[model samples]
Target: MRASEDAGLRDRRRELLTGARGRVLEIGAGTGLNLPLYPEQGIVELVFTEPEEPMARRLDERAHARSPVPRVVRAPAEDLPFDDDSFDTVVSTLVLCTVGDQDAALREARRVLKDDGRLLFLEHVRADDAAGARRQDRWHRPWRAIGHGCNCNRATVPAIEKAGFRLEHVERGTVPKAPKIVRPLAVGVAVPA
Candidate 1:
């Protein structure tokens, strides 16, 4: 991921995290890649949820090195253990594609976020053009197998709306250093509708 990070993924993380504040919950925070990009202040607490044990272990190690270490929990996005309206912000970066149940995970994100909280996200979504989208469909199975369950063809924007959020801002772009089939991206902020 360092190659991806260096190739503009890190910049996207920085941009997406710029507005994050108060208590924040990050879903599917694999290995804590976004940890270093969070703002230096404003956030009172940071919590990360990762269901995969190996990634969680690495997240724990990386988190403890920070000045105010983030709390890492072993949980899946679909079954967040947080109370309703528990966080002022919820972040999802390159995660929605791989979740076992994308809608359930998003609903859980909406469930935990305060009514006025933001959902800052950067996710690889289905391509905009027909040819590119068809390519994603064609390669999805192989990509999923190689990417370890990541489905690069998800229609993520509509899913966000369906899960009870309204898009406040969105930018359609591409992921650098990623395969063409998985490069289309949606970076945005949404709030509970």
Candidate 2:
């Protein structure tokens, strides 16, 4: 089931990242799973922010293995170690739900992105359905304990909007073979207005 869920996530991530170009910053680059999916054309450079030491090491190894090496930094999303407006694109995949402070992380993402820069995301968020929402609330506590503090109940889209981004495109749906309660996946692009 986990494998199937991961496969679904990979497909969705690929679709969302297809047209990425220029300097891109990817938050929570866990194990660098998204590294190989990046588009070859248009993208000039890639930067990854990962706080976990082990994961960062793996990401570094993956970057070095790539034809064009990507920059990998060990840092938290809420406090980016970069100049303001430093990237043409910012991306987060399955990241927002585990952030210690979603608003702060989002603000950092907005700060690093250029005025017209795009924010692309592939996140698993709280369900909009009432029954599903209830189920999510029930499962989230136990899930968080085992899933590295990740919550299935975080409303990622609204949080992004509240952090001062204008949604340009959005597609939400359930990931295959996963519990409907916690499988509300949102893929979209936003920009700071």
The lowest-lDDT stretch of 10 consecutive residues in candidate 1 is 1-10
Best-fitting candidate, measured by lDDT?
1
Mark the regions of model 2 whose C-alpha exceeds 4 Å error after superposition. 5-7
TM-score (all chains, Cα) for each model: 0.98, 0.95
Q: Please report, in order, the local distance difference test score of every candidate based on alpha carbons.
A: 0.95, 0.89
Task: Give me the candidate number with maximum TM-score.
Answer: 1
What value of lDDT does candidate 2 attain over all alpha carbons?
0.89
Task: Give per-residue CA lDDT, model 1, range 1-193, as digits (tens).
Answer: 6777888889988988989999999999999989999998899999999999999999999999997989999999999999999999999999999999999999999999999999999999999899999999999999999999999899999999999999999999989888898889899999999
What's the TM for model 2?
0.95
List, residue by residue over 94-150, the lDDT tens digit for candidate 2.
899998999999999999999989999988898988888888899888989977798
